[model samples]
Target chain A: AQTVTQSQPEMSVQEAETVTLSCTYDTSESDYYLFWYKQPPSRQMILVIRQEAYKQQNATENRFSVNFQKAAKSFSLKISDSQLGDAAMYFCAYRSAPSGTYKYIFGTGTRLKVLA
Target chain B: DAGVTQSPTHLIKTRGQQVTLRCSPKSGHDTVSWYQQALGQGPQFIFQYYEEEERQRGNFPDRFSGHQFPNYSSELNVNALLLGDSALYLCASSLNSYEQYFGPGTRLTVT
Candidate 1:
């Protein structure tokens, strides 16, 4: 069974600054996908970024990036120049590689607050 | 392109009652997946429908069942619901890959 873990329950970042959210997982399968999803008060789950297990390079999308360490099973999200809009609950999720199977194992979300 | 959409944004049900939630996948998507997000917790996968057939499921029990229509729209049905079933139910759509596009979830509260 694959399990995602986020150690931080709450995190705050100064506006215009940067913040990194920690995420780790346990999985026996070597091939899989990692993802970062953000949910605001509206409760809309938005896909932030993704990292394929086979890709060693990290995935970056605008201000959001990931530190994907496949060997260590660590996938952390970094928000550069955090804005007030970035304030939301960020969740780390894992997807299996098998076809016709899209089970996503998610971590306990880290609530991000953009502070002044 | 319009993204995934869910109906009955918020609903409250009593114990032992049954509830039905609906989802429409994004344009061009052929698969629909359902997940449960508890307060301050991650969304747990319930099941997925592809080709109008159940393709995959998670650790959830029989109480959580679903159906996919010919148009790829889907429904999540919960029977004899309990208070523990209160959560945000999300509908996600994808292709052969699992990099899903999500919908604004339906908030289900079992009283």
Candidate 2:
């Protein structure tokens, strides 16, 4: 069984500043995928970024990037120049790659509050 | 292109009653997956459908059933619903195990 853990229940960051959300997962498989998703008050889940386990280089999508440490099994999301629109519930997810199951294992989520 | 779409943005049903939620996959997507998200919690995988057949399922009970049509659209049917079943039902679509695009979700309230 695989599990994802998001240590922060809530986080606050001033607008135009930076913040990092921590996430860790336990999995036996060597090949997998990690993702960060944001859900706003509108109830829509939006993909923020994704990282492949085999890729040593982290994944970056504009202001959002991930710090993936395969040995430590830690994948963190860093938001640079946070904006008010970035306020939402962020979830970390894991999925097996290649021939494994396609189901996603998600973390409890961290509610981000962007202060002005 | 339009993203995944779910029907009846909100639904209110009584306990012990049955409810069905519909989902239309994003254009060109052939795989549909369902998830249950409780208040303040992460989404839980319910099941996934491909080629009009169930390919994967989570720890949900048999009371939760689903079907995928030939068009790749899907429906989630929960029988004898309980208060615990109340949550946001999210439908996601992907192309061959790629990144899934999520729908706005159907908020099912069981009272």
Candidate 3:
């Protein structure tokens, strides 16, 4: 009964600028995993970054980073120095940690547009 | 090594018809998961196959079935399809870790 929420339906940022996409989730499990995935117009889903609930330190992958506020139930994606290639539909996902539990609940995506 | 791969990139089916989608997991991956992504929406988990058996499933109906081969490849079968069943079917592969690698997805259009 876990759910992920992406408040923004669409977002736009100028090239070289930074953009942040917001996401929140509802889960009862203390230990879990959060992920951000990007789907381009080509319809390929690509993993952007991931953060574990136990890790206090946020996750960062080059220009992509996540601001994970466990208590607030918020996990946001921050894209630095945005490029045109970064334009895509971004989805936030939640997965439980227990064995035999592989269901991944996802949020309604937020489409990102990078302007040149 | 190649990432996850799906067969018949596009498929068109009519109402009440049945369809099957195939997936080949990435090298060394033994687990495969299937997801359904509707237009303008995120992908929803349908099921996961491991060790040639179903390990997990979502809130889908019984009409949505699947099978995993000995090679770790998998197939998603949808019987008596509905118009609402039209979506992008994605296949993901993983080891014992939580991280999963996704395929390009098969676009299914049910008319």
Candidate 4:
């Protein structure tokens, strides 16, 4: 079984500052996928970034990046120069690869608030 | 192209009643997966449908059933609903890749 955990129930960040959201997962499979999804108040889940276990390098979007410590089973999200628009409920997810059926197990979530 | 779409934006049902939620996958998508999102929590995978057949399922029991049509549209059926079953039901469409596109979701309330 694969389980993802996001320890911070809530987080706050000042606009233009940076923030980090921690996530860790337990999976026995060596090949799998990790993801960060942002769900705004509108309740729409948006993909933020994705990382593959096979890759040693981390994944980064425009303002979002992930510190994927595979050995430690930690995949954390980092938002640089945070913007108010970034405020949302963020979820961390795990999907096994070979991807044997494309089902994802998600973490509880961390609500992010951007303060101006 | 339009993204995934779910029907009955909201529904209210009593305990022991049954409910069905519909979904239309994004254009050109052939796979559909269903998820249940309780208040203040991440969405939980219920099942996935492909080629009009069930490809995979989660820990949910037979009480949570689903079907996929030839057109790639899907439906999630929950029988003998309980108050614990109240949640937002989401439908996601995807290609062979791991990335998936989600719908707005149908909010179900079991009183």
Candidate 5:
């Protein structure tokens, strides 16, 4: 069985500063994908960034980036130039890369508070 | 193109009652997946439908059932609901096995 862990229950960041949310997972599969999702008060789960296990280069989406360490089984999200709008619940997710395995295993989540 | 859409936006049902939630996949997407997200928790996978048939399911009980139409639209039906079933039901659609696009989610409140 595979599981994702987000140890930080909550995190705070000052406006325009950077913040990193840590996540780790237990998985036996070598091929998989990691993701970071953001859910605001509106209840919409938005994809922030994704990293493929096969890719050594980390994934970056504008202000958001990921530090994916496949061997360590750790994937973390870093938000640069954090703004008030960045405050939300962030979730780390894992999905098997094998065909037909479509379900996503998610971490409990970390509440991000961006202070002005 | 419109993203995944679910309705009604909110539903309130009593315990032991049955409830149905609907989802319309995004344009060009043929796979639909459902998830349950409890308050302050991450979303849990429910099931996935493709080719109008269920291809995958999670750890949910048989009381939780679903259907996918020929048009790729889907419905989630829960029977004998419990208070623990109260949560945000999310619908996601993808083309093949690509990244999924999520809906705003329907908030189901079981009293």
Candidate 6:
């Protein structure tokens, strides 16, 4: 079974600063996908970024990027120049390859607060 | 294009009662998956449907079931509901089973 874990329950970042959220997972599969999703007070889940397990280079999208260490099974999200709008619950998820079940395994989530 | 959509944004049901939540996949998507998000927790996968058939399911019990229509719409049904069943139900759609687009979700409350 695959399990995602987020050690931080709450995090705060000053506006215009940067913050990093930590996430780790346990999986036996070699090839899979990792994702970060943000949910604001509106309760809408928005994709932040994604990283392929096989890709050594991390994935970056705008102000959000990931530090993926496949060997250690760690996938962390970094928010550069965090804004107030970045305040939300951030989730780290894992998706298996086609040969596997392909269901998403998500971590408990870390609530992000951007201090203005 | 419009993203995935869910009906009855909020619903309330008593214990032992049944509840059904509906979802419409995003345009051009053919696969739909359902998830349950308990308060303060990440969404948990319930099941996935493709080609109008169930392709995968999570660790949830048989009390939770679902169906997918020809138009790519789906329904999540829960019977003998308990207070523990109260949560936000989300629907996601994907093409080729890769990245998925999620709906706003339907909040279910079992009192």
- Looking at model 4 chain A, report the run of 10 residues with the lowest lDDT sum: A93-102
Per-prediction TM-score of chain B?
Answer: 0.98, 0.98, 0.98, 0.98, 0.98, 0.98
Q: What is the lDDT of every predicted structure here?
A: 0.92, 0.97, 0.95, 0.93, 0.95, 0.94
lDDT of 1 by residue, A11-72 (tens): 99999999999999999998999999999999988999999899988999999999998889
* Count of clashing residue pairs in every prediction: 0, 0, 0, 0, 0, 0
Model 6 has a DockQ score of 0.81
Winner by TM-score between candidate 3 and candidate 1: 3
What is the TM-score of candidate 1?
0.97
Q: For model 2, how does the per-residue alpha-carbon lDDT over B1-111 read when each residue is reduced to its tens digit? A: 888999989999999999999999999999999999999999999999999999999999999999999999999999999999999999999999679999999999999
Question: Measured by C-alpha RMSD in angstroms, how accurate is candidate 3?
Answer: 0.8
DockQ of candidate 5 relative to the true structure? 0.88
Residue A68 in candidate 6, Cα distance off native in Å? 0.8
Per-residue lDDT tens digits for candidate 6, residues A48-91, read: 99998989999999999999999999999999999999999999
**Candidate number with greatest lDDT:** 2
For each candidate, the DockQ is 0.84, 0.87, 0.84, 0.73, 0.88, 0.81
After superposition, which runs of candidate 2 have C-alpha atoms over 4 Å from their true positions?
Answer: none
lDDT of 2 by residue, A16-91 (tens): 9999999999999899999999999999999999999999999999999999999999999999999999999999
- Badly placed stretches (over 4 Å) of model 3 are none
Q: What share of the true interface contacts does each candidate keep?
A: 0.97, 0.85, 0.90, 0.64, 0.87, 0.74
lDDT tens string, model 3, A1-116? 88899999999999999999999999899999999999999988899999999999999999999999999999999999999999999999999998878878999999999999
Tell me each candidate's TM-score.
0.97, 0.99, 0.98, 0.97, 0.98, 0.98
How would you encode candidate 1's per-residue C-alpha lDDT over B26-111 as one tens digit per residue? 99999899999888789888998999988888889999999999999999999999999999999999886467999999999999
Which numbered prediction scores highest in DockQ against the true structure? 5
Q: Write the per-residue lDDT of candidate 3 for residues B1-111, one digit (tens) a residue.
A: 999999989999999999999999999999999999999989999999999988988889999999999999999999999999999999999997489999999999999
Task: Give the total clashing residue pairs for model 4.
Answer: 0
